[model samples]
Target: MAGLSQIWAHIYTTTLVFFSILFLELVILVRAAAGSIHGCKNRPITTTQYLKLVEEKNPACRYKTGLRMESLECAVCLSKYEEEDEIRKLKKCNHTFHKDCLDTWLQQDWATCPLCRSMVLPEEVVVNYWRHQNYQEFDGSDEELIFLLSALHGNYIRRFL
Candidate 1:
């Protein structure tokens, strides 16, 4: 009887250890699944929200250098800006346009400009045009473009200080 009792105690201890390991593995699997699904379930920012953000942040919208606000056309859509229009301004380039237009245009195209087949940076399309025109004769490659962009960013940061 004592031998039987000891056997039962050993069996119970082994079962408990097995179950604890199983429970820990299940917890890890559940956490991994939740992380992957979380990203898939979430939606990106809407176009309207993007436009409002740009309008609030950019000082360019407040005033046009010499061009009339009405004369400005979206480099992506070739459409002019209208009141309450949702638009995004390229960070590297100062081009503004309807968000929907640019989003659709970028989906199909890769490097070429939406308006012209000019080699310009995707985000800084407007500034890229000016940069290309000025630096065309300077023998600057893509690497040089990147270096110039970094220098410009540093200059912008320094001006604030």
Candidate 2:
């Protein structure tokens, strides 16, 4: 009976993981289908908001001090991070990279970290955090946020597509 229970438990755990992955994939698919604009359209942030989010979360610096062995290299450029190099450490995945490289990647409209492919700037999450930060300047009535959001959301499509 003990061995039977163990087998059943293993099967249950495996099935649960499989279903979880399937559900997440379905969600992603539906989200993608429901969107008109490409790139980080699901939830986009402006450079200003991104900088604020970075400051509130991981905080970039002119250079990193090599506190860890893994963060010494920029994944995008495949170059070693040196003194006076601008570094931005992602808050969600904790992956560090050259600021310019990451910015270029993001400007190309990617919503994920290059290494982990994790969503870094999902709008809801950041806005919720800003709300918690007492960001009265970030509410729905703000004109700048609206303009920037429109620019990020559809300007490229209008300009290039």
Candidate 3:
């Protein structure tokens, strides 16, 4: 009987220790996951500051210009932009289109500009302006120039086509 009691006590103690360790590990994991989510939410805007280094006027130019140009007719549907019309301005590339037109076009998963198939950055125009102003000192390489030109070509193609 004495030996049996000792064995039973040992089993209970070992089980308690094992469960306590598991609970502690679970608590640590939950805390670690919560901390990582908080960190991601608060991640600093280092890219915004880097963009500021190449600042020019009209950071949100695409949104503004697209709204203004919305009054003009949509090249895709040949329909006028009405105040009640659902519209979507392409990010960084300030081309505006009727939401219906854009959604239908995007359903095709085409990345080129709709009109010219050229690239446009409504926001980065400010950056390009700054770069152009300082071109003599900070001119980009030939490859960079080619890339920019190609993007411009694409934008024009979408606009005209």
Candidate 4:
């Protein structure tokens, strides 16, 4: 047992490093899952809406091509956008990318602008992210929930006071 103890003493630093790396990886995975709001939950965008989003791009949007110093490029594909190229401009963030490129990226559950990671929910996309957070199930729409909340708030305040 003395020989075994000596061996462990020599390798303990290596064992500690391995476990530290594993703990760090686990922390990273948990944080990533927490940040992934729509991951595996929201439905993909429709072709028509994707096309409409593509048309709403700011024509003056420009990016450096490294060759020309002034031009537009898709952040996802890193390809230069020509005059007739289809591009999608994300609102609120105003980041632009190739229509096809953004469509593919958006289909994946992140639902954010690839370049800016901003929330990019379209008007038609009705994702109630709070659906899973509710303690009680209600039979009405989100608008009704808002109306019911005020009454609940008054009851809570009166009871507490």
Best model number under TM-score: 2
lDDT of 1 by residue, 1-161 (tens): 99998777667655654564465567667866766786732323334443344344432332234544433677766766666666655553445556667555543454333554543233444333333334432233656544544453454322222
- Ranking according to lDDT, highest score first: 2, 4, 3, 1
Candidate 1, clashing residue pairs? Answer: 93-124
For lDDT, the strongest prediction is 2
Evaluated at residue 133, the lDDT of candidate 2 is 46
Root-mean-square deviation of candidate 2: 22.2
- Please provide TM-scores, in order, for all candidate models, with all chains considered together: 0.29, 0.43, 0.30, 0.36
Deviation in Å, model 1, residue 4 alpha carbon: 61
Could you give the candidate ranking by TM-score, starting with the highest?
2, 4, 3, 1
Q: What ranges in model 3 sit over 4 Å off?
A: 1-67, 119-161
Count of backbone clashes for each model? Answer: 1, 0, 15, 1
| TM-score result, candidate 3 | 0.30
- Quality of model 3 by C-alpha lDDT: 0.50
Residue 7 lDDT in candidate 2 = 79
Expressed as tens digits, the lDDT of each residue in 1-161 for candidate 4 is: 99998677657645644564565567667755664865654534444654454345423243334424323677788977766666666666767777678877765544677877776764335233323223243444655444454454444322222
lDDT of 2 by residue, 61-108 (tens): 777464664667899999988888888888888898888888666545
- Global fold similarity of model 1 (TM-score): 0.29
